[model samples]
Target: MSYDKEVGLRMNWPMIVYISLVHIVACYSIYNTITRPHYMLTYVWTIILWFISGFGITAGAHRLWSHRSYKARYPLRVLLMIFNSIANQGSVIHWVRDHRLHHLYSDTDKDPHDSQRGFFYSHVGWLLVRKPKRVLDAGRKISLNDLYKDNILLIQHRLCPWWNMLWCFIFPAIVGYYLWDESILNGILLPGVFRYCFVLHATWCVNSVVHQWGPKPYDNKSHTTENGIVAFIALGEGWHNYHHTFDWDYVTAEMGAIKQYNPTKVFIDIMYYLGLAYNLRRAYPKGWEHLKSRNIRKLGGEYHVVEGIYGIPPFCHRTVTYVQGEGGGGGRLLSETQVDNMSTTDEEGL
Candidate 1:
């Protein structure tokens, strides 16, 4: 997170103050949770709330809305909206709009949270400062016409912070108070504020950590990676290489949820089983093997095959990195299919 490209941008005081106070409250809540064992239940509630809020992003905003990896019935859409509102990273329209921009421009100067600038900018500094004119211009070119069609999305966006507050903060606190006799103060600070803060950082890791670290299976070009530690914490979003290369894949990773901790996929699958989600999609890309082999030869290391957590065993694949450090790749996703459509010639087997 050392890098910074915020040189000419104006500071956003309101966002700065909100973020500053959020961290302060979140840290104080942690201290309270530690010193006051009586708040154990509240702490547990925080963990539970974190999962719920995370789903709103992983399932609702990023996958369902941003990429449309699957279609949801009205009931499911409404539920996802409520779930996302609880997360409050942004309303659906804004989240999808910015996320689409991120995928479109990726690490370029036009990318909203371009990783090329540095980890801090990609993770959270983008919010602290106004975006450069180049980024804002590209963002305008990327349309949100589809999102605007959803009246529910319009309502949420119209209400803005208040809608966010109702679900993310007030509702969680209300639940804690009624369910466990928790005081509104503790409920708000711990589960509402601290949990929100925790999820924010976890979500941000996909932008910063995976881009800088992890192995890139799909290619050896972009800074994206297949990060397991990130997937573990960020609910499978750490499959950055795959997600960036093949955004249509609802599972995000090529492997199923059992191979990784993708509760978000599990939730979507459950929704599908219940007939609330349909048109689930996946991509059938070619040249994965060719790309892997080519990169392996380029990097010039002896090859071995194995499957461990996010490929940490023999530390190699046909061309992808099973372990970490150098010799990996990622790309930008585009269109409703979320397909990069990268082409490669067929290669002889190694």
Candidate 2:
């Protein structure tokens, strides 16, 4: 078969329907939970799994693994890996490779889920098309030697499907067997299938709603935008503009001042402080300054252009640049001397 012919066949609707039925089943389970109120335990399990899946996608799959924003220790990586599998998303290898391609060729044909392809494509239509060559070619471009060498990520990748089945289905069914003994709806539907579907759609929103609508606090041309509501639903992942611009910055704690986008940031901080992760990165003060809005809505002071050693104005309000590196200020606002000191610290840290 010709390559073009193969590409045409790749976007098969029947294939898509077959593959996505699992998700449909899961969604139906969530729907049925309303009727089966006796099994409240399943509801709690569903919410907990839903939350864990967000952490797996945002912190584990997207941030740590895909973007290489920070270094995680073995224990945390392993725990996140298990959650990731339970989320029933694609394996880390596929997730990272596809994501790297998205970054490198955002909003273009090369992007796996370019919004320009249309909303449905961005949401899940891209998955309907088999792009084995594209996936492989893209994977080759983004070398994940670090992850390959990491024993934890490797093991997780290997056992992902099985782990997904066990935790998301088998384990839940086991609990139901012990309790209900006869209700498939109680065990499998409420907790297992339903919870998985709820989590899947929530995570998929990052790919869909985030790209389609939101404030462009940073770079809008890239298709990623910042939305506070999306962030609330996506566990802080809706701060897409900040993420795309400063992909390596560990703290997506706040997008400007208005939206409190920090669930993922808090999760990262906990992992870092506990030594489960390291090398937490922050947006440069100047770069961050550019993204901040200059308005009354901005609670922080408006940015000022202070001439510095190079005569270039510092970008942020916190910056107090001076010719001779001499000035005075206190608190979050920096004095010239403090700016110089901080610049030196930044250089040394690098």
Candidate 3:
């Protein structure tokens, strides 16, 4: 009966049609690349561009802005802004607001992509259908005041439609037409449409595949899980159980998983070494082992994780050490107030 419960599915036909058309064209583009051997360069570019766009979401929107998992210098922030435009999922402010809401409310009716609504609903149906009243009401409580103050996010939010069209599709097509001597049509199909669609689905998997499969080691009582395959495809975000348990950790996955399939972690690490990123946070004060699958969350209660600049829930359960800079194993621990101020200062990066 729970599975059969109707949560209202008024269809947003335009969105449904657009998504369907994108998938069909993406499939055709894959076939086109195979048959047209000359499209080798375009194919390679598609893969490279996919990761570039994903960085915008995973690093720019999710980690840096949404969760405040780390802080980035102006140069890196600008670069990530450009990358997020290429990803074209949404503006950083909108994306972060939705993400924060998803975390605070999780799989309840308030969650935009509620996993209990079924895989298709979580994966894409939420977008294809008009949002229910509950979802809208839940979203209203989640504010974007912090995000709006950031000039970088504000500009991106204003021009996302125009710039996204340019970077996500038109620019890539132009490169194929001029640099690669590929047809504009093939360019749009291969790297433009196909890659855009590919990134969308892969990110969506975190909402669907991640919630359904894998182990819930950190908080067994929670709805999320850890899936290595999703992590690999998503550039390391698929450790949903760990992430939900320790949402403030900049690594998102396990502490010492740089060698694993978590390129997003490595990308942030590279930026840290280059002095482009700093003030990265770590797991909850007690780390994963202490949770021991305990229900660390209670509805509308304070989350028991480290607080970041962007979204610190009402309460934290303990006063233990939360590593900074490196993975959870080593690094100086900052008091809560220090962590909040670190993002704005010119302090030497770790």
Candidate 4:
């Protein structure tokens, strides 16, 4: 496969060094975990911080900010911004910029994490290497007007260095020293470095494993797919095929029910009940059926349609246009009239 443009690789020494140190310290922390079993408080703190930081990326950077799947209140935005710094992925502004471009130009050289490049490059190697020129150029073409207008994102981006130090290191160490009565060095290494590395790898799994493996129940035109393991660990981000097909849907997956492993969707629901989120966008069931019917890969018998979990009712009437054209000619359009009929047919068959 050829790309419209090519991006030569460059070394990002700072990122390389930072990642190397984190891994080294994380390995050392493993020894601490085995020998120092009395620091149960530190282990608990690591787990809590891991959840907060992971949610920060999945809920804040990916869904709310990158896709604008729903509107969040000011307080929710502030909370997400704080936790996002602890995640240490990057500033929300740059993170959102890269993500939007990845969706727009997926699998191409312009994509920030081009999965076609192979697992290592897509997983974390992209971060270690200097961003390709095409990525930067294509990112500029994306409209981040909404993100720029966001005061919370602006403040986080401006004070990112300070915030990262305070939340990712200083705060954790302080809590460990004062509250847990543990060595500050131990605090920094265990919960700080180890937790950060764990969350980082889990998030990266969605970019690498979910794309390279798993079932593509939705669209297969792209490399993205749905993986249950990644969804559980990434807090609902693993439904990559459904996400790419319906990017505006808040849940990122078709099944948003409580039984689903999408904790992020549940969190958004909680926010909605508390009036912290509104105008939640979701894919229409009829639209999903229309898309599924045209899917290059057929869904197996195990697949069944449920009332879309967003509480939106299925449309009784819908129109699907099939266009025929060659070389950009004005195509003839065919509209199917029996939209409800087709859905009923599918349901009865299921």
Candidate 5:
């Protein structure tokens, strides 16, 4: 199956069937809630599962695995792997592969979920249709060497199908059944199917809504934007513009304070304090200030300021050390001012 120019658009039947069934079940669950509401416990369970699965994708797959934003202890890594499986997007390796490609060629033909293809395609249409040759070719060029070195990630990928089924469907349904003492059917429909559907769409919204809406305060070269609504639903992943600009930042935004909606950063911070995570990476203060000063949205008078717990750090003129663990490589200690001056044309432009 391919979507190359010569091959045209080919339907990915497996994905199509899976998505269709989930939606159908979700719709039925909605009707069930309206007509014959389940015990409040069932609703509560659904919301809980939604957060768990959503955070799994945001913190586990996106930040931890894909970006290697920080190092985690073995126990924390295993826990996040379980959460990632429960999210049911894909194995860690597969998710990181496509995500790295998306960042490398975002908003372009090579991007798997290119916004230029329109909202639907970027959101979920890309999944229903086969991957384009350009996307596949680009993905192959991106390195997964770091991920391959991680035993936890490799083990999870090897057993993904089994764990995904267990954590995503079986475990959630069992919890629902035991908590509400309801029919197994009710448990599967409400917490399993409905919750899965909700989390999937919420994650997809970052690819769709985040690109189409919000302000591009980091870089206007891409269509990605900062969407607070999406950040709230996607568990702190909605700061798309900032993310595209500073792809290596563990916080995913310039503002790293906890009072913001970035629960993922908070989670990582907690792990760091507990000695379960370390080498937390973030954008340099000088680079962030430079980008903020030159924000296209601000220049156009369309950017709105939202006060948060931490303002942007003041600019630094002293020499800076460029550490590497966030993007999965060795550190390079360069002069901070020199790096800031060169950042405009460097691979990771501020």
Candidate 6:
């Protein structure tokens, strides 16, 4: 069934035993490292997990499955699915259900991860506690037409939670035994414990900080807002405000086109461009231009005026006014070509 009432199972004992053993091994390894002090190796392992889990969450579960930003080839999808499972947030089906509900109800009492409940509540409390009745009601009503049909995603949904125990914890313990120079702590602590914990909070910040604090570019009433600080840590997801305003557009800064480091979009675009993926939906040039204007205004710039824009409807306004510097000054009205070129220049600078 696509939708059903969420049921509670007394926490799975087998899963608990498996996770605890992994933790014990990892802690032992960390203790070993305290005596050996292989800080460099620990750092290296941390970087590896950071990149893998970061991509797994962003390119795999998020843009790929949750947003359907682009399509991936089977091989890449399989690899990404494995890493996402290791990230151990939850099954894609569950994550998407909660995420789709967030978009539908947004900041209302129905939002599964609403920031109105406080930062910690939004970040992790919702996951730890029984879901609210309103959220369960919304989940039962949510449509899964897009997700239910994809065989690959369905496979991911089925295997991700199990992998959470094996790949996320057990594999790290095994890897520590083999390559961590007789130091299980280095392997388990750096890549296993730390990686899992870090990725969890990074993903959760989108529902928490991105909404509670940041600049609102498009629709101010939307509780979601853009947070650059959060994005840097969360792998370019900080542009939450832009994302909510135009969820259909693949990239955060309008159709996967960002002037700076949007590694998430970059990875997806590469896969799509290289024939490993396809059907990437981007905002029209005019839509992107409007976003730029709104961004400038939101970032304290003033007087964004664009004239004779072709694709934009005649009645559609194409300008923004905001404070720039100590004294506000006006810049030239930018055309689609101008905006593209300017963005290119900014990217080059980056």
Model 1: per-residue Cα lDDT at residue 54 = 91
Query: Using Cα atoms with residue i matched to residue i, what is each candidate's TM-score against the true structure?
Result: 0.82, 0.74, 0.79, 0.81, 0.80, 0.73
Question: What RMSD does each model have against the real structure?
Answer: 7.5, 9.7, 11.3, 9.2, 9.6, 10.3
lDDT per residue for candidate 1 within 1-350, as digits (tens), equals 23345566799899999999999998998887677644567778778888888998999999999998999999988888888898998788888888999888788887878888789989999889887887788888888888899987888899998999889988978888888888887888888988899899999999899999976657546789877788888888887887787877888877677665678889999999999999988763443444444544433334322233434432222233232233323322122111122233322233
Worst 10 residues of 2 by lDDT: 308-317
Highest TM-score scorer:
1
Whole-model Cα lDDT of every candidate shown, in order: 0.77, 0.66, 0.77, 0.77, 0.75, 0.66
Arrange candidates by TM-score, descending.
1, 4, 5, 3, 2, 6
Measured on C-alpha atoms, candidate 5 has an lDDT of 0.75
lDDT of 6 by residue, 85-125 (tens): 78777776777788888888887778887777788778866
Residue 179 in model 4: lDDT? 92
Model 2 stretches with alpha carbons more than 4 Å out: 1-9, 12-18, 132-136, 175-184, 253-259, 290-350
Model 4 agreement with the true structure over 1-350: per-residue lDDT tens digits: 57654445678899999889889988998887777753788889988888888879988999999999998999999999888998888799999898999998888888899999999999999998887777888888999899899998999899877777678877787888999698888888888888888888999998899889865545645688767778777888887888998999998887654544787888889999999989899885765876646421122233223222221222011123433443224644333222222443345423
Candidate 2, pairs of clashing residues: none
lDDT of 6 at 163: 59
Model 3, span 135-162: residue lDDT tens:
7888889988888888988888898688
Off by over 4 Å in 6: 1-36, 176-182, 255-258, 289-319, 322-350
lDDT (Cα, tens digit) per residue for candidate 2, span 185-238: 567776677777766667767788888886554443457776666677777776
Model 3 regions more than 4 Å off: 1-9, 284-286, 292-350
Top model number, lDDT: 4
After TM-score superposition, the amount by which residue 30's alpha carbon in candidate 2 deviates from its true location, in angstroms, is 4.1
Worst 10 residues of 3 by lDDT: 309-318
Q: Candidate 5's residue-wise lDDT over 102-205, tens digit each?
A: 98887788889988888999999999988987788888898999889989888878987887878888887787677667667777887888888888999999
> What TM-score does model 2 achieve against the real structure?
0.74
lDDT of 5 at 263: 75
Clashes in predicted model 4:
0
